[model samples]
Target: MGEPSHEATTAPQEDLSSEATTTARGNHAEELTGAAAMFANDRASQHLGITVDDHGPGWAQCSMTITDIMANGHEITHGGYIFLFADTTFAMACNYPGSTTVASGGDIDFLKPTYVGDTLVARGKEIVKQGRSGIYDIEVTRGEEIVAVYRGRSRTLPARKPTTSDAAAPPVPTSP
Candidate 1:
């Protein structure tokens, strides 16, 4: 992987399909969410509009838009979509492989007003984790300027239940 372009108003890093992406970010393809990850999407995005970008921890990034469902009375953007960007990326970073995480709480600062046709991106990095709780430093960046920074927490699950795959791998045939 080479280095990802550090730019403002950037498009989705092309088709990021290469296992060895041309980005400084190390490959975490194994952690990529398929249909298995919880919260695959919310009813708001219309279509599934969330994805992980080529980034490393304690750093992560995601992109979402100001859809009709996400616009406010003024036909501008809303806070929920902003939270969506933040929370989604945070989930990817915390729920990684080892941690089964849920959002404990968060604080978001809205720096500037957003409008329709704006493509917003959110980024999060795990700053610290201990026991069953961790703090994530988050940034909601539009273009190059950061519109918001969220401090979020992931509360660990006591004992997570088996996923479909975990339970569907048929038991080994018993030999008499």
Candidate 2:
């Protein structure tokens, strides 16, 4: 197979650009709603240069280019980075506007070694969601080649009543 290009191979540039625009605009208007809003404050994913390409009610797609910093002693991309990518995608899929969902557990199977400069796209889809629990499947790909598959279990946290301290504290201001 040919080497994967640095450009996204799954979604077209126009589509990805449009989605990015929508996310940016949404951030300005809502600032604290939906998966896009949740991702806005995600320092870890942002630090790793992971971008959320698309997301909706039950699915999300994100991409990250493997950098030299991500490489292990043997020079291949480390497994933790791949897992983090997939886990972030899974988080985007299961979270909604009003709820906070966290990964209960996840497991990944690496199918191939990933090298520095390789751009990997992780697509996550909700397999099932019942009550407060959900199952998601994420596939990590380089071009059309599958590199890893991750299965994630999620649990939506129960809404907690405001404590006396919370009631006494002033509301934190959100960024515009």
> How many angstroms is residue 5 displaced in model 1 relative to the true structure, after the best TM-score fit?
18
**Candidate 2 per-residue lDDT over residues 1-176, each given as its tens digit:** 12222222232222323544454343232334546556755668878988877777678888999999999999999999999999989988888766778899999999999999999999888899999999999999999999999999999999757777767756655657
CA lDDT, every model vs. true structure: 0.61, 0.78
Worst 10 residues of 1 by lDDT: 20-29
Candidate 1 — which residues are off by over 4 angstroms? 1-36, 39-48, 55-58, 161-169, 172-176
Q: Tell me how candidate 2 scores on lDDT.
A: 0.78
Residue-level lDDT tens digits of model 1 in 112-165: 878777788877788898988899987887799888788898887876466877
Please report the TM-score between candidate 1 and the true structure: 0.66
Clashing pairs in 2: none
CA displacement after TM-score superposition, residue 94 of candidate 2 (Å):
0.7
